[model samples]
Target: MNSIGVVYNNNHELHDYILKGFPSPESPARLKRILQHFVDNRVLENNNCKVLYPANVSVEDILRVHTADYFSFVQSRSLSGGGWLGNDTYLCEGSFEVLLQAVGSVLEAGKAVVTGQCDHAFALIRPPGHHACADKHSGFCIFNNAAVLARHLQHVYSCQKIAIVNIDAHASDGTQNIFYADPSVLCISVHQDPSDFYPFKGFIREMGSMPALGYTVNMEMPQEAGNPEYSIFFEEVGLKVLEQFCPDLVILECGFDSYYKEKLAKLNLTVDGYYDSVSRLRSRWHTIVLLEGGYHDDLGLLADVVLQALADNRYTKDEVNQVNLLASRQSSCRRIFDNKLNELKKLMSSYWEI
Candidate 1:
């Protein structure tokens, strides 16, 4: 199968807002250079990789994960102006165009995987979406890209089972809220504990509600959580849980903020950790990766790491102080983690065999 497929819009630049005389942190070009790297490396030449774009996402698609009123509110907000949707989100006059392209790319990305066009696809667009809830926009997100694609797959192609894996340093609160009561979509987020993060949500105990109790899973790592911690969770828990769910497809909320260089949140995931995780999941199901968050100046380099991991089972490890990081974490981190796991088991038992 062709290893890589892309969904992008050149006009995505239309969403580039120059409000405060600075580029938005969530820009469309974040992954563009990395895509080119694959080309320079001959990783994409003659491979049939593609850039698929659809026009603005249909209103029906938008409403699948958002209330009409909220949708209209954002439409109007686009006209007047947009600002911090919440702690990390920002919106401006051009946000609508950006938002549309974001959703459109996501839709096309999922379509490529579901339709057997690619073993994996990446939707590289901006204004990251995991933080955008059905009712509101926040955390630099506008349309909840991953959520929309999950629903679209279900509605368009009869994909009844879908899994969304969010690895941003911040929890996917908006995604959890959207799928809280739905059984068909399983949302798993691994992020720094919300106790000291932006959204201040994604606690372990906040599993899904009745009928979907166990579908939403969260792992809250302590600040400065590093590669070893992330890999252990995936090996011991993430793989175990996902193997049991057996979704028809996997949608990754692929955000790079967990890197050590990122200032937005404290987590230390080197490229080796990333490569191993994706490699483990590579054969399970087709994957559609949506770029969600990551604002470091080295965004392109990290993006290349992700593509390498996904396409060739290869990644360049970053130099890290593993010994120091492990020793420096809170003495209570493990204790807190165990308690969180117990709470999650108790909460999810009603709907799943936790």
Candidate 2:
């Protein structure tokens, strides 16, 4: 059995957005639910799973991906009373401290996996960072957590080739922007079509620029694309591209917004969809999963599904039937998905043999 290292943001509550006079869906409740589920279900008591503590990360570590000026701005803003940093991103008082803890936990998880302290690790930190850029904060992200950890792996462990795969419903525009010109990291985001989604820019044509032309891949699943569509994507494009890239480590920007019940997005990835996706990626490479987004009440259930997949354990029966769910969707949903898939294949044909 592969040992799974679970990293938590010990002081995550301090970064709560509700204290800033608003009820944000990216509340501290997200982590609270996941942690509570683990305790109640004895998830950590599993022989193959254990909790890991994170060390404080320094400014140098953060500077690997963020500019010094932006770092200072986030820190100062969080030090003072919290305020919006454009694009609906907020940083409450002491959020800077929580931000460090979040980044620290992510870096610690990466360190544990790369150094063989654990076969795999999951950092259940808050204030998701996928939408954050080097110089600005957006979509509730203060720093690019995955990007920072990816750079840390390369610097400390000498991991030259890495892949960051995002299963989040929203596009990983920030992470892509940071690594678009670099070939060392391959960024693939499988998300709801960004045409009508938040951060609406992860189109199929937005592959990496210049020398890293095919390094970044984005698959825009139509609204209501459920388990079947995700599986097809994996078998056809996702897996094939990863196989060709041959990364040393795979960092999963795991998010549950693609789940069927999510309010923010219309994608319908259930327990089975998440398990299949994470398990397949785990089967191929050592994965360090960093929680990104997912505001549904079933966050706990989905987190358990991910842990089971990581440990190679049999999955618990999904609460919903895959067949019935698929049958309920409009036929046009699948038609739209098929068209998008074909277009993705055509766009990447010059770069990959899909």
Question: Which residue pairs collide, candidate 1?
Answer: 89-140
Model 1 lDDT on a 0 to 1 scale: 0.77
The digit string of per-residue lDDT tens for model 1 on 79-180 reads 777655555556677778777777888888888788887788878777788988898878777789899899999999999899999998889999999999
Which lDDT values do the candidates have, in the order given?
0.77, 0.91
lDDT of 1 at 242: 82
Give the worst 10-residue stretch by lDDT in candidate 2: 41-50
Lowest summed lDDT window (length 10), candidate 1: 14-23
> What are the per-residue Cα lDDT tens digits for candidate 2 across 106-158?
99999889989999999999889999989988898889999999999998889
> Global CA lDDT of candidate 2, please?
0.91
How big is the positional error of residue 294 in model 2, measured in Å on the Cα after superposition?
Answer: 0.7
